[model samples]
Target: MTALTLIRHATILLELAGQTFLVDPMLDDARSHDAVEGTSNPTRWPLVGLPTGAAEVVASATAVLITHTHVDHLDDTAIAFLRDRSVPVFCQPFDVAELTERGLPDVRPVDEVTHWRGVAIRRTGGQHGTGAQADLMGPVSGWLLTHGGQQVYVAGDTVWCDEVAAVLDVNQPQVVVVNAGEARMVTGDPITMGADDVFATCRYPGRRQVIAVHLEALNHCGLTRAELACDAAAAGLEVTIPRDGERVSLFQG
Candidate 1:
């Protein structure tokens, strides 16, 4: 069985491929990080408090999967916590050197398809935003996790573009989780899935589960949970927006 528990922000405790994979852990107390400069809201990041203890969040995690090394995704506190544990840390090839330097002993890079244990982890492309903003944000990745005839796609920090469409068309994953918040910088467009993009994803011509995350925690993420829920209802579409620390099943087999 594959399931996901949203710890906070983009921090997801994913039970997949027969292991409990801690994905993009930003394990910090609320308002620990400074607010993004020039963002619309100058509020300190992680607006809400953690739903549970941070230790409880990492207790059962057998492995770690990082979409990127961005601070919001992997904070300094998480680094300290991970530095103590020697679990397998999976990431894109671009991040191997950095993670290794951070005292992570087992930094495994998933270049395209990596077979760990018995499951397959496929690294997929993502664009943080369009044109210059995307370039500035550098390279990020999505993931395709397959095992036991079940597939779960985690669309990390990306706007709806060819890369996302390709994943939907080709992989045909049973559960698709997109990082939606319409998170924006001062000048550019949203760096993550906005309302329209998420609606497009849900309305995609297929019977797949669409779950939205990466919302409400950060200051830059303008999309609120209530707003997204209202929009989803108005559009008559289905999208699972799990609360912080809430667990939801994405795929089961």
Candidate 2:
């Protein structure tokens, strides 16, 4: 059995095989303009508050997985909170040097299939966008976690691409968690998975469940949980749009 909880935008808490894994924690209340540009009114930006028992949840985390070094994913508040902790921070090889530069302790570079406690983890390359957009965003990756005979794919901030689909085909995950909010700037199309892309990803074969996050937390991400759920249902996909503190469990033999 594995328990997966949504802590906030792109933040997840997973308890599998007697270990806890946290992903992309943004616990601060402050909105970041440097990361998401063209936002004049900070108050207008949608904010997803931290979970009710976030501190307790994080304190129990045995390991942390970071998809990227973006401010929203690894903010000052989150960094300070994890700095003193003893858990290992798993991230891409490209991010290891950057994390070390930030003086983050116990930061480990994940380059291939590995295990944290008893959970099997596979890291694969991910594209933030196409062409120039991807180059500007730098290297990003997604995680495939298998524990208790169940596979779950956590698609970090990425647009629809062949790599993502290939992961689905290879891993055949039972559950897929996507960072889908159709995030965009005034100048370009969405940089993250739009509703249509989310539908396509979730509709893939062998995906028993799908969870959507990274919505309504920042100014650039315009989609809401309700809208995502509606779109998923309209597309005949079974999906769950969990609130910040919501928990959804999966049992496997």
Which lDDT tens digits does candidate 1 get at residues 1-253?
A: 5789998888998897679989998988888878887687889978988788777777778888899999988888888888888789899899999998988888999889998877888999999999999998989998888897788889999999889889899888889989999999999889999899999888777668988999999999999889999999999998899999899976542
lDDT of 2 at 19: 81
Superposed Cα deviation of residue 99, candidate 2 (Å): 1.3
lDDT of each model, Cα atoms only? 0.88, 0.79
Write model 2 residue lDDT over 40-148, tens digit each, in one string.
3334332645665556756878899999988778776778778778899999988988888777799988888887777888887777867787788788888889876
Q: Judging by TM-score against the true structure, name the best candidate.
A: 1
- Write out the backbone clash pairs for model 1: none
Residue pair clashes in candidate 2: none
Best by lDDT: 1
| Structural RMSD, model 1 | 1.3
- Stretches off by above 4 angstroms in model 1 are none
